[model samples]
Target: MSSIYIHIPFCKQACHYCDFHFSTSMGKKDAMIQALIRELELRKDEFRDEVVDCIYFGGGTPSVLETEEITLLIQTVYTHYQVTTDPEITLEANPDDLSEAKIEALHASPINRLSIGVQSFFEEDLKLMNRAHNATEALQCIMLSRKRFQNISIDLIYGIPEMSTARWIQNIEQALALDVPHISAYALTVEPKTALEKFIKKGIIPPVEDEVAQAHHAILVERLEAEGYHNYEFSNFGKPGAFSQNNTAYWEGKSYIGIGPGAHSYDGKRRAWNVSNNPRYIKAISQDMLPQDVEELTLTDQYNEYVMTRLRTQKGVSLSEVQTLFGDKMHRYLLQQAQSHIEAHFLFQEADRLYVTKKGKFLSDGIAADLFMLNLFQHPFDQNSNQS
Candidate 1:
């Protein structure tokens, strides 16, 4: 039930909208890799001797690392952690870094799943995003990866202002055409302090249109459904049994260990994150200290976390389970708060489970906020739910 995530903080180029803690320079790659391995060994017992079921390599571009470095990291993890016999080991890669040799090396490693960053399969889209790979590489890498890894997932972005509706459909079709089993699609957002934001502020790049993003989301759902993919999470689709176990563990409140700079870990009751700077993290680990911060979750914080996460998945929230976990008093309060959303058709209650309708899925975050047990200690009962 425990998972592990290792962040590889190096990228070939910076995406205009990326605010993730990654460096375009490869200067510190070697030191960072060694530091990650050291950190893994130092914190081997963080998971309470539970069998590790999932290990995910996420970040700047795990694909950019030399295959031997990755192999060493994997070997170090296995040497310390009690990994399961059939662990779901995933590596996040990018097309530009994927070569036949690289894929072969990955196949030889412990990695069983590949999550490639293929933001778009169109050349213009790639340029606008400032991605390192071109359209051809994006399309070809998936095909090549299928020969090496069967449990494959790719990342795709939608809602770019210049991207046409037809093009978005083409992206979905292309993904289907590649026979990819899983996909993580997301709507483009201009985060503050990112190049995309600066471009918009400087009037260099057009602002993202909400209407366009919503339309693309609708198209994505319809097309993927027709293609027989389950819309498991709001932005994730999988072909039966192919959901990312590592990510699912996160949503289900399972404990996990995270290594490397800017990585996060949650131990059911508390959450922690390492320092985001590579140099800082390396220096701390060298001194045998984990450069991280931790926070213990309060009861209200736990309830709100459950509501936010469960509402994002297709299964929704289970009233009985909520009652069992948070007690009957909290359960009744949740039902009272969810009443208006259920009445408004934004949320539906069936057989003790609550789910967001397709019409309301786009507004899920807003709805979740509205349904939050914010004033849990205040009301304790008889709360009025508003249909926002």
Candidate 2:
């Protein structure tokens, strides 16, 4: 199934760890919304033959928009494209934005899922990350959201410097107490040029240790699984029937259209991304021109991506599908690359699938890299956008 991702490039304040494109000023908010709608209209034909199963509002902070503005965007999609009878529409919101009134209004809208950015339920963690919401706001918002929405996901960050193991467990317990159906937890990595990196460099904040992150991940897996939450993807856990359709589609390599500035889109064979600059994106859309760069994936590129994404999921990589899609030569090459990992008990082959063991989950990305068939036809644009 196809999906649509709309990036709202405005936030109340910048999170220290964030490197994603966004602006703190809302001076051009209305203009950005219109530009997003116009981009959707311009790209509707790309999904003319495909039914849209998901419409995700990702940020900066999508919750910053009023319910009416959000409805208008969704209505635009319905007017221009084929949407399913019941699509999984998600809004990535911050706790401070999800006031009681806001939650009620959002519940009335077409948004069926709420992915709240409740990074931590501790005051210190919030302060360290410069999150817009405090611990109380985080707890209160989720409690309020549960009254209106059943399908909800909360983001939590682990591996914060000076976070003790007991404190991390308390964070998990706090989430479990909220009863949200999905949780997407990630380790805090200091991206270059971000305030997080700067703080660590200045010795103002302690360095984030990988060993600590790994330990936290182990606790996360053990605690969530004991509570019956499926670790569907490496960083995402969901109750049965509560998996994120939007993210699952992405992991399965389904085609999707990404609207707004800094958004990325992919068809089966080609990927495209709009300009990250808000002014430039608006100017181009206003002029009825698509301000985007496109990349045509080579066979090796496709295989590498497939391996990277599939290996992170519970479904693992299908060895037979690998051979079927690539060839006997590439398939044999993959087996050869994976042999060492399998020998180390980090990976195992059961029937036609190769799965990462619990011991190897934390190292999945590196393992996938080792198995990558380096592309000789590397596109220059790919150097910047190849992470996914």
* TM-score leader: 2
lDDT for 95 in candidate 1 is: 95
Number of the top lDDT candidate: 2
As a TM-score, model 2 comes out at 0.97
Each candidate structure's TM-score, on Cα atoms with residue i matched to residue i, is 0.96, 0.97
Candidate 1 global lDDT = 0.88
Q: Tally clashing residue pairs in candidate 2.
A: 0
lDDT of 1 by residue, 1-388 (tens): 8988999999888999999999888988888988999999889878656889998999989988888888899888889989889999999999988888889889988889999999999999999999999999988888899998999999999999699999999998999899999999999999999999999999999999988998999899988988889998898999998999987888777889999999998887888999999889999998999999999877677778888888999999999888777776778778888899888898999998999998889888988888777754575532222110
Computed on alpha carbons, the lDDT of every model, listed in order, comes to 0.88, 0.94
Per-residue C-alpha lDDT of model 2 across residues 152-263, encoded as one tens digit per residue: 9999999999999999999999999989999999999999999999999999999999999999999999999999999999999999999999999999999999999899
Error of 1 at 74 (Å): 1.0
Lowest lDDT 10-mer window, candidate 2? 379-388
Of candidate 1, the 10-residue stretch with the lowest lDDT total is 379-388
Off by over 4 Å in 1: 375-388
